[model samples]
Target: MEAAIRASQAQLFEAQAQLTKSQADWERAQNLMQANSLTQPDFDSAKLALATAQGKVKEAEQQVRVNNGKLTESKANVLAARARVDQSQGQVDASVAQENRSQAGVDSARSRTVGARSNVEQANVALGDIFLKAPMDGVILTRSVEVGAQVGPGTVGFAMADTHHVLVTFGVPDILVRDLKLGQRLDIKCEALPGRTFEGTVRTVAPEADADSRVYKVEVRVDNSKDVLKVGMIASLDLVDKEDSPRSIIAVPLGALMPNKDQEDAYQVYVIKDNKAKLRDVTVGRASGDMMEITSGLEEGEQIVVEGGNRVNDGQTVKVKS
Candidate 1:
């Protein structure tokens, strides 16, 4: 900037010097004209020279103004550069701070990870002192762990289902999945409970498919308040047709009775009325293979026409094949 100012000042001085010489020459010419020694043309020429010199001074001054403007713009550019440097410095500081925090988090997580592993080891050591015990006053149905066995956290010591309140499990087919619901009535029978009848309801259904049996696991909660039922005792799980049952009742297919399909919102079934095939809607209660409950929209002995329903349609005549 200083260099630029010096150059502009030098140009102005040169212009001033030219103006001074023109004035001195013009004065001499004026004197000559006044004495009639210089011609009128010569006097006019001197005057015009003075005017041109003045115009040069004005032009130099205008150039100075332009140079000043350039200097101002240069200063502004410097300030902008400084501001950018400051902004960049702030960003670097913030990034460094964030990196430091990340490093701290990593260190903390490492410590926690070590502590978690230690706690796991300690838990295993403590299990050495903890012995498995029977939970209730009942016969043991299974023994998964023996004396001096090395067991882990998830190890099963034994399985002891309550014998005092025994209930049977059965399958409900997909065809009858719709006719059952929770708390629906069930007719249960066991050779052990001969000459006596036991009543139950659809209790629990599995939420997954059983790959081995291809059937659902359905649970029937029985009222063994009498303590007559025993665990592992096989029994018949009888589901009453929902159609024959009253309102608020449900039935499902026996196969769909598997525990897994219980989570299904509903099941499907077919209805045959007045020699016409109609798709009937019903709610699911519990799953039992090959059969289910008719929670609603059905009645007992209604000629359900279970077989060969795939070929029939609504309002279409279908002869009972068997």
Candidate 2:
């Protein structure tokens, strides 16, 4: 299905390129025909080519649409296959439990119980199938079953989400994914909670990039003790490196640093030493919002120019802005 989609997309591009060339040729033929420089047979041929190109473009577009639908159906088939596997596992577990219960019954019914247990074991081994199990530990978001509903293999019994440690899953560009690691703590801000900021750990970093988008999925797990963060809430997150250790670094406004033109990954900051603007090379770490952590070349209690540092020259005398 994916191959078909790719082929259709290629055909669409080829059709579009042909259409462009055909339109240009048809326009040129029109001008030549008006001037009596082109024969009627040649002009008609250009017109026919334009019409054919237009039809090919339309046909390619429809093929692409059809291929997309087939791709969606293919994905659904994969999900159904997984569901069947889960259901089979559940049935096996139920059979095992029944056998265990029957074995613990009275001595008088021991023979009957033995037969029943053997029958169950045989059925379990022969069929090799079971019902669905909840994928994770969480509250049921939706219950699709009633008291006595005849559920089949693919029937969804319940929908659940882990809200205790609410996960905010988002995609990051492949280029930036190299900097991310599991267990790294990040700061998350929810649109629902205006000024409040929440801390979350990077629970999952997808090893592969998405085929279509070329981005990797990253899930951040935030502790929702008070249930402040709910499911489906839109959140903005700041990815931070655990190596930075924000608590131990001297954080300053991001505006304070100026990029060094001659060097890569180097920045310069103006520090007020004895009331004079002194230039210092600093190694910057992870950034969170307006603040940036200084991993080296800056210390706590040092006065650094946060504003109007762009206009100040290195080692130049600058007035203190009240």
Candidate 3:
């Protein structure tokens, strides 16, 4: 395309040169005719020649114009073609950037895959240790692992009862279950311990009732730091208070309250006052038997006698003393 344009430009330049020469010659002929030095016929012939030369000059000029116009169009086409080339270059650059981004993602995925493979190997090694061995000097609660049986990680090889700390399981009726979160402290006691006391907390609760039964599975996390408790043991449970209830209404028997209410939303013990216990509605927040968080109702230093509140009436005047 460029070669063709150059050729046309050359032709335009040649036409321009020829037109200039013809115009100069015609001017000279006109001057001769006017001077009368030439004969009449010769003058007429000169005039005719001049007119013909002028015509030729005009024709040459027109030819130049035509060639120039074609050249201009060719130049425009070349400019447009170059613009398309530049745009294609930009697209190539963008493709390179995308390729680099994808390469980085692939590298990350490969690293994660390697790490996961290592974890699987570690898990397999742990599973290989099914051979029974005493974890520590302790009594076993119950052993369910047999000589050769495929078991999952959650399988209890043998329960140590750890006697050092205990965990109790129970259900929190739906009526009392609500808004109970993990880590809330609880007071616990077992029939085997009788008067002895324990402490625990809301550990976990079932998301749905068991298929066989409609009770919410609840777990109370207890600490037997003194090694006085064991696993799989039955214990009475009571939630001291719901997270939002007031502290004053959470009082309960140190022996009756267990940190393991399987996570009851809350519980309350109304004190007999003014001769009536009033069963005054209360919101328990947190409790530990000695005292509880009263989210609402009850007051600081109010008489909440725990001895015989079950028989009291609302607003009843009774002996108010701690």
Candidate 4:
């Protein structure tokens, strides 16, 4: 547009120059015609030349005005385009700011969720610590703390006793321990409960002897479903072998029994079958003298190793003595 305007201005200047020269020529021709020195035709020719130059000047000036208007319009278009660009940039900036704010809000919510979950877990632990659960079914004999009382670690909140099954521990000499076995029944007499005899079963017999008393500890489990037996009461039990009414159990020599390596308070014995020593797990009952009762896992007619039984292994070839 500038180029067009410059070309139009140059054309205007050339036309103006021609108009000046034509005016000068026309004036000289008119004076000569008046003095009868120039002819009428020549005078008319100069006047026409002047008129043509004036018209061309007017046309060039008009073109310059048109070119200037077009240049102004082009500049207005450029300004409009810049405005649009600015507006678009502003919108993009606003969108980016909004996205950042949304992300911040999301992160804050996530942090709060984590904190809430931690609080919930801590509350659950505190609730568990607030209540006391008895290890087994029993009655609470004593409660040390009142309601709303503060209790800390190792606080004796309650004293409980299991009335379903009562445990009686007693000491016996080593000679008597040889006859005691698991599941043996004994008559338990409590001094406080007169004329009431609670039948108890032997649960455990000590494997080692006590150094001070040279006695073994025996545990008895007595059923007290009626809640007749009280805790801390003096009780006495009698160990009597029911020999007259024998249970017809399978008995084996004490040497044939070995402690099972995999189980606690369990015994295993080797049985001779087709000249092979096969190890068998057995539950034992009362022991009388040098013989131990095999309550299970052995047949009546089966042969077993009595002497040197520790040297044999399972599934080994063995010779039976005649």
- Relative to the true structure, candidate 4 reaches a TM of 0.35
Which candidate, 1 or 3, would have the higher TM-score against the true structure?
A: 1
| Overall lDDT per candidate, in order of appearance | 0.62, 0.73, 0.56, 0.75
Clashing pairs in 4: none
Please, what are the lDDT tens digits per residue for candidate 3 over residues 1-322?
Answer: 3343354456456656655665665667668767865556555655666666556556555645554565565555556555555555555455556765566555555555555555555544443332245667667676686433578868777776455655677655454456556887767877667777777888888888654334466777777667777554546655532444542243444322222233353334555556455444444333332444455556656556465544444466666553
Per-residue CA lDDT of model 1 for 33-122, tens digit only, reads 889998786788789999998887887777677667666765565565555555555554555567656665556555555555555455
Tens-digit lDDT track for model 2 on 1-322?
5555676699899999999999999999999999999988789989999999999899889878876765665555555555555555555555556755543343434444455555555545433232234567676688797433677778887788877788887666555678887998888887567799999999999999766445577889899978788887766666544454425668887668777877644678999987789988886554556666676889888888997787678888877766
Task: Give the candidate number with the greatest lDDT.
Answer: 4
Order of quality (lDDT): 4, 2, 1, 3
Q: Please name the candidate that would achieve the greatest TM-score relative to the true structure.
A: 4
RMSD of each: 43.1, 21.3, 44.0, 51.9
> With candidate 1 superimposed using the best TM-score fit, by how many Å does residue 67's alpha carbon deviate from the native?
99
Candidate 3, position 212, lDDT: 30
What overall lDDT, based on C-alpha atoms, would model 1 receive against the true structure?
0.62
Point out where model 3 deviates above 4 Å: 1-133, 143-161, 240-322
**Residue runs of model 1 more than 4 Å from their true location after superposition:** 1-132, 148-155, 205-216, 240-322
Residue 311, model 1, lDDT: 46
Give the candidates in order of TM-score, highest first: 4, 2, 1, 3
Scanning candidate 3 in windows of ten residues, the lowest lDDT window is: 254-263
